[model samples]
Target: MASVCINEALTDDELRSVLSKLEEERDKEMFGLVCKRWLRLQSTERKRLAARAGPHMLQKMASRFSRLLELDLSQSVSRSFYPGVTDSDLSVVADGFKSLRVLLLQNCKGISDRGLVSIGRGLPSLQSLDISYCRKLTDKGLSAVAEGCQDLRSLHMSGCRFVTDGVLKALSKNCANLEELVLQGCSNITDHGLADLVSGCRRIQHLDLNKCNNVGDDGISKVSQACSYSLKKLKLLDCYKVGDQSILSLAKFCKNLETLIIGGCRDISNDSVISLAIACRNSLKNLRMDWCLNISDSSLSHIFSECRNLEGLDVGCCEEITDAAFQGLGSMETKLPLKFLKISNCPKITVTGLGLLLGKCDSLEYIDVRSCLHVTKLACDEAGLQFPECCKVNFTGSLNEPDLL
Candidate 1:
């Protein structure tokens, strides 16, 4: 009689227990190859997968991985042959992965309102969703999602141009627990929509309104007032309509703001910048005020003196910023925590100012002085020798003559 194999005698539960002990994917694959039963068990235990979108492939995945919790069907620009995921593919995902928690469908051009409806009805347990650049989706689809997925904490809908105030209203009504919302390039959003959203979702911590031209001081002030304590990071890049009143409101109410980007907000002046620096001195860590031409040495002086915890700063292209700004920074008695600095394209800055900054900031790790008319490549090369071994300086366009070597 043939000897009985110990592996064959083990029950399904014991096999599963052995599989759970293997940490590496290679080890798990080897275990599955030992027998047909192990292979079947491995397929059922799989939890996350990222694959090209197709109806037939999705069907096969659903049948094989019944407990999959995360699915990524985002398409790459180089792979244009695959016409992108459609509503039918989403229907299959909704029907099969009822316990799904995270779904990413970025750049799925073929998906529209119909696909989102299927997701809303089926995936009530979802906590995060990224449909960024899915331009075909509008208020109708996202409203359905807000109504169904009340557990949602993060939502990214960047470049969904068709979305307007209506979706914000819907989300405000249902998704009160939302913490991160990225609406970059949704140009149709206005002050009223923002006020409504912030009133309901007071827990929002990170909000990005980059390129939402219609948003101005009124909307931003409302956000600062409602989500004052909870807000930590905000990006208003290229929101030209935003001016001093918005920043002033942030300084007064949002004391916990850690990161702020107001680049291209040309109307911002030294007064508001100084106010913000004083108010958020202890908490502010990163600040970018590039192209805010109205700010000058006074704002930089206050920032250097007050924001003791500041680690990163960018005032690039502020034409009015001159050597005086660095003079104040150099005069500081206390060692600065600043690690990154960018003064690129400021025509008034020269090697004298750069030297002053380098002398004081021993903690510097990265510096960008590119396009400063008076700064030379020769000077930058000498400065590189003095910087710490880890420091890197970008003087890309400073070379006016050929190197001697």
Candidate 2:
């Protein structure tokens, strides 16, 4: 037939060219289904894959996808019923994917120090690794990765309770090019670990120390000073030991800080907030100060007035914040770029303040005024009806109107 003649006429290189032009995975897969030769070509060209982890499956993948760059074996979601990837499976990965650049094993509970040792010894080209919530991993395993994979750029070890200052020291000494580090809920790490980390890895741009209770002003101040120019996003949520000094240091040193999340740092007062608003006004975009008990109207006023580029603000649970904050926003000569606002659980904010903010900031995409004592459900319903379809407002627990019989 004509189709058979045309397929026979096309060279292997020409077939490969056609395959390269196909962008969709489904289309490429369809091309492979044409014949065994096309299927072989497709397997050779594949670079990334996500699959359920097992020693036999991984070995098969390794042999098929010779040029693979990324592998994701994260058992964080639906794979809870299955026994996750273990040290033996990791050894298969280490032997097969020596050129692998990214490996994500988040919440793979079966993987321990033994598994990581194979990863460290094998994948020297690794640039990003996420072992978050892998509770079995300890400092020994992480340090081995740091020592072996010097080109690492992003490392996320959130909820790895056993990781300590030893891994931090190893990272500082080895992975100088590290940029993004998340140690969220790694409760064992203290100021000493952070100091060791910043001493060498000064290029860190995004750092998360959320729930790191032992990390006080001293550790954060050191980070502010060391990675001042490069630091862009910082999260200090529920770090109760962090007070005004850390914020003040950030304001003074980290002029380019774009996103700051200091929620649950109750000791952060208006003075440091004001300074931060003024200092990082040009660069600061998203800020969350929820549960910051000491910051009030003055801090919010300065923030609204100075931070022209701020796109998100979360000042929830700050009992002192009142209508005065929104009044400042309404009075601005130019409309703020704020698209996300959360003022939930603030008893002092009323319908008047909500109205003022809504009237002025037409760009708002999301607003949460949940549990505001003075704002009625009727008022919220009215505001929702008047606002454009793009904006979403949450007014949960607001006073509902009495129904007529």
Candidate 3:
């Protein structure tokens, strides 16, 4: 049977039902873009229908939206310019998505500061804003939001190279209620900006300053000293300036930390990891330390022995790790709280190292021992796949393990 169009004789409820079904079709964007009537009906009711529309379709849909509690437009990969797409298309997207509780316009290259200003206008209830990787965004555009949207609770400006400490100051002063901030790849930000924000925002729970090379011990010391009470999750990926002192400071003060990611922080040695794990061992749930070459068997052994409650861990490319350290993880008590584990390119991990974990940690649901060259088929079979997740295995020499449909 042919689908009933919204233009036909249909009540609002019937149109909504039809639109809901249309959303499931692969060409849902095309369905919304054919005419103004479809765009109007689809845009206003899109929260339930579509939240991940590509740029052109999103631009079209934004025309008729009057009220929205949240607007998430992150990770739109399509760069193909639709011939019909014009400046008016962008204007609609900016002007319509008003009163948003959360607005994520990350990676939208087409949107300049003008577009940002247009979007920020009249967004009185806007709380969470993620402009991460929007290269065109400048202080002027963001300042407008700081001056206007005072209720913002969380902000993600990662990869926003143009944004500087001025924006941070504005956010620290204006968005006082902010509880989460991600400043990854903002090379211009200094310790002053970081310290000011951390000291000011007492309610912050999660902070990601990954690849923020400028920040050193001075900045991190202030954050550790001040925001320890509420800071739960902190990611400092590739921040080379931060050393063991920062970790020690964090462990001493931020005892409530549940998730800590310190990937590519080469300045840290085994002592820092050991101290951090010891201090926050009882509370730490997820810990990732990828490419931290200085870490060795001693570090892992200490963390495993102490961080007994740890559930998720990733120690990728930590070449210094030795096989003996695996035994501490092997002795993990059952109910076996550890669920997720990733150990890639740790050369010493043969069947012996991995086998210990398989026999002991019965609750492990996700395991990535990829590139551990010595692991054979025999090891996999001996370590039974009784868990709810990742039951598929290649028992034979052939790596052709059939995926369960």
Candidate 4:
């Protein structure tokens, strides 16, 4: 019955209107099969396409969607339904979509330096490229990108372990307009590489160095000095080599930061955190300090007193935080209220302190208190009853896996 209804003849305006409402790729594919006219109309309307098919499908799409602006050939690393795209497949896309602006080849295992070089030479108009998890890519592939795509703005090469200073130098020399660069898990990079990267990309606003173990205080200090003027978001998760000196530099130079994550940077203490609060008080909205066990109530007090606009706060595993920290947050006056709060595994936070803190944060929508030994069922019950119906409290005893901050 559904097929019969869809198969009925419709005018061009009616078909175009119906096609405009279909956004999902699967839905468009199904609609295209309704008739020859529908197939033609779908091809004309398609601008973004995501598929896990191999070379043949890439060739078909290249001809079908003449106006395609973005193409995502990424596939799940765990279980791809079809064979992954290869260098030959990428060459077909490069030849077809010469004006493509965005390309995402994340987790495409078959893609290598040759494929990337082919893409770089063919698609000079590409602006955003995400080759994250493409472990086969190295400096050679990136050098091709630098030589070809000068208008590039955003690039994500996370988990590409072979990347080093050479790749950074090439991109810095060419992609001057680059604003966002994600080097997460690219452990080959050292301080010198980071210094050169930031020096060249003065307009960079967002930088991610999560799990880049070699990037220490010196690298971060150089970043603060060079890109601080435009930098707004910085993530340094699990970079244990970084110390309070790095945070101090960021607090002093990158005062315009809106989001800051320092999870697993255990060397930071109350002094640097306090300075960070005072420096970015008006601009900071989100802060993550999980696993910074040395941070105590004094640091929390300083942050609450100065950074009233803060919306998201994660003090997970901060063993030294006590009731005083919550009280400090309750006393703060600000129009931008806290929306998300996570204090899981904080041994010093008791039921009394948790209740008091909950009563004050009227704007809070999500509260996570897992593994708080002092917080009992009574406290959880009271919290649920007191807060608005819109709020969701997670007081489960078990610890949830850590997520992105």
Q: Model 3, residue 236: displacement in angstroms?
A: 1.3
Candidate 4 clash pair list: none
| 1 or 2, greater by TM-score | 2
> In model 4, what lDDT does residue 178 have?
92
My TM-score estimates for the predictions, one after another, are 0.91, 0.93, 0.76, 0.88
Model 3 CA deviation exceeding 4 Å by range: 1-65, 73-75, 80-98, 329-335, 378-405
**Per-residue C-alpha lDDT of model 2 across residues 1-405, encoded as one tens digit per residue:** 444764678887888899999999899999889888888888877889998857888888898888899999888656666548889998999999977999998888888999998899999999999999888999999999998899999999999999998899999999999999999999999999999999999999999999999899999999999999999999999999999999999999999999999999999999999999999999999999999999899999899889999989999899999998877766667877888888889999888788777776788877777888787568667666355467767777443421210
Every model: Cα RMSD to truth: 4.4, 4.7, 6.5, 4.6
- Ten consecutive residues with minimal summed lDDT in candidate 3? 396-405
lDDT of 3 by residue, 1-405 (tens): 988764677776776687777635556666677777776766677552235455566655555565556766555556423222222434565556664577766676666777666656757677888887777788888877876778888888888898888887787788878888898889888889877776557778888888888888788888888788888988888888888989999989999999888888887899989999899978888888878889998888887778878888888788877678877765555544777776767777777776666666666766666666665455555654343354333223234422210
Superposed by TM-score, candidate 2 places the C-alpha of residue 244 at a distance from the truth, in angstroms, of: 1.1
Task: Give the range of the ten consecutive residues with the poorest summed lDDT in model 1.
Answer: 396-405
Cα error, candidate 3, residue 156 (Å)? 1.9
Residue pair clashes in candidate 3: none
Alpha-carbon error at 226 in model 1, in Å?
1.1
lDDT of 4 by residue, 153-242 (tens): 999999999999898899889989999999999999999999888778888888999999999999999999898889899999999998
Which candidate, 2 or 4, has the higher TM-score? Answer: 2
